[model samples]
Target: MSSRASLKANLQLFVTRRCQLRCRYCPILKGDSLMPLATALKGADLLLGHQSGRVRLDFGGGEPLMNFEVVREASAYAARRAKALGKDLGFYMVTNAVLLDDAVLEWAAKRGVLLEFSMDGAREDHNRYKSAYDRGLDPYAATRAGVERALRAGSPHFVIVVASPSNVRRLAENFEHLYEIGVRRFDLSYAIGGVWSADEEKSFFSQVELVLTRHARELDCGAVQLGNARQRLEPTVLNSELMVDPDGSLHQMSEWMFETTPPTGEAPFHVGTLDTVKDINSLRWSRFHSYYTLVRLYDGRPDVRAALLNNISFGLRVGRFFRASGARLGKVPA
Candidate 1:
């Protein structure tokens, strides 16, 4: 096992699968499943022990605040452990913002948890995609109130806009609306499952280019900084972003859990469980190596890298087309 530090700098804990809203494109398998306190803490401990330097512990879920106690406890524990071990620890969470309240906001503010709220576009767009589990509850209103409450509390947060085929045309309008509501930092994540036509793809990129250009202009004049743009412009490696599922199983990519076909000829995706692994560094090393190999293979190639970073649908199309060709070649009976 290599004693060299793993390339992973972030660990995402899917604390709970329970959520209050039913978003149309959510990938989370919503249920009552939640990570046990012991499991969450153990995963945190493992992450701190194995990874070096500054590490980010991200709490995610159908809505992580659904199991707020676990999030609170695990974050505090990780903070203390990191302090004693002389490590820099950062905390983050991804939530719909429908469940946020004054108490939650205050707690997260004191703990310095970077809360990311999901809002599609404006009122109509948001409500169309994200609705409360109970039809009577207005998700858009609730989320708006939550965002206001966080702003009042001076909590550190940002908005993430998910662009689907249905709402791609309204991307610029939605961003402008969010900006008007005092959201400075934003992330635009396009839905990967939808069928995007050629016209839709062109429109999507056009809108993205327009919005991002305007935001960059704003940033230049000391107006607002776009979080996603900063992330892209900054020099950062595709480090291992490990996901600890609710069952304590460690996986390399969150999407791997949803893969219909097994990764037959690729490196193993599931490394080990928190309770079973003796040397976490070795597991991290293996995962890092697998991803690094892919990065090296594609990073220097302009066509491949641009296709991957610019458009999700194009990337998926290329990936599937290549994988199918490979499978056919494997069955040549030579």
Candidate 2:
């Protein structure tokens, strides 16, 4: 890796494993246990000590609002600590929007929390997974209603949509609706739906690319625009704050960061608990760190110091298994 120092700006923190919505694609539902609140705090402390750059933390969840107390305490704690150290802490959460009642909206607004709501496309698309058949509320309507409530409460609202093949064709139309409703920042990501499989991802990636390009073209035409005049391009897949799992495990991205099935059968990764900084330190040179370190090394760019510490036992076996396995399976028909 090149010698450029690594800068860690955002932390994506997962606050809980319990969620109200049963989205088919969520990876946390596959995990075993939730991390305690004390453990989460310790992980935050570790990030502060080792990582350089703006220290922004994002509180994520099975439903962060479900653990509203944790959300409040962690954000407030990080806010105070970051400010005293002359660093900025950005706080936010991703939710299904079903849980955004008036009280929740108010609390978030008071704390300067930005809310990212999941919307598939239209009523049918949005409700397909959110409402399913058993729970028959209109998720599309609920999301719209919730957005209004949040905006009314003076909270900044962003719309994040996962594009599936079922709704890919209507990307522009759905986004236009959101833009008209005062949602300026649109995050578009490929849908990782249903069971995780290599074959499925191949097809999903192609479809997502096509849909994303189509939407990007509409933005170019300026048919619908955010009220802001900064002239920024819409973010297709932006980096978010680090995720703190219920177990106080630090994840670089969303809950999906822990989605791996280890070859050694050790399960996925967890950095450490919040109360003990030692768990955080013990994670040094573990598979987690090795993963990032190898990426930096292979990228052959300005090298950043690998703060990702992982246990070689788990990471190394998993590494060789994946590399060899992928090659062997590459020629198999998708």
Best by TM-score: 1
lDDT of predicted model 1: 0.69
Could you report the Cα RMSD, in angstroms, for every candidate shown? 10.5, 11.3
Clashes of 2: 27
Q: List the residue pairs that clash in candidate 1.
A: none
- Candidate 1 root-mean-square deviation in Å: 10.5
- In order of listing, the candidates' clash counts read 0, 27
Q: List where candidate 2 sits over 4 angstroms from the true fold.
A: 1-6, 30-35, 50-53, 132-137, 193-242, 251-334
Error of 2 at 160 (Å): 1.0
lDDT of 2 by residue, 107-208 (tens): 676667767787766676676656533366666787778877776676776667665545556656766666667665555544432222344334543543
Q: How far is 139's C-alpha from truth in model 1 (Å)? A: 1.2
On the 0 to 100 scale, the lDDT of residue 73 in model 1 is 90
Compared with the true structure, all predictions reach lDDT values of 0.69, 0.52
TM-score of 2: 0.63
Question: In model 2, where is the ten-residue run with the lowest total lDDT?
Answer: 302-311
**Model 1: residues with Cα > 4 Å off, grouped in runs:** 1-6, 213-216, 232-240, 256-268, 285-334
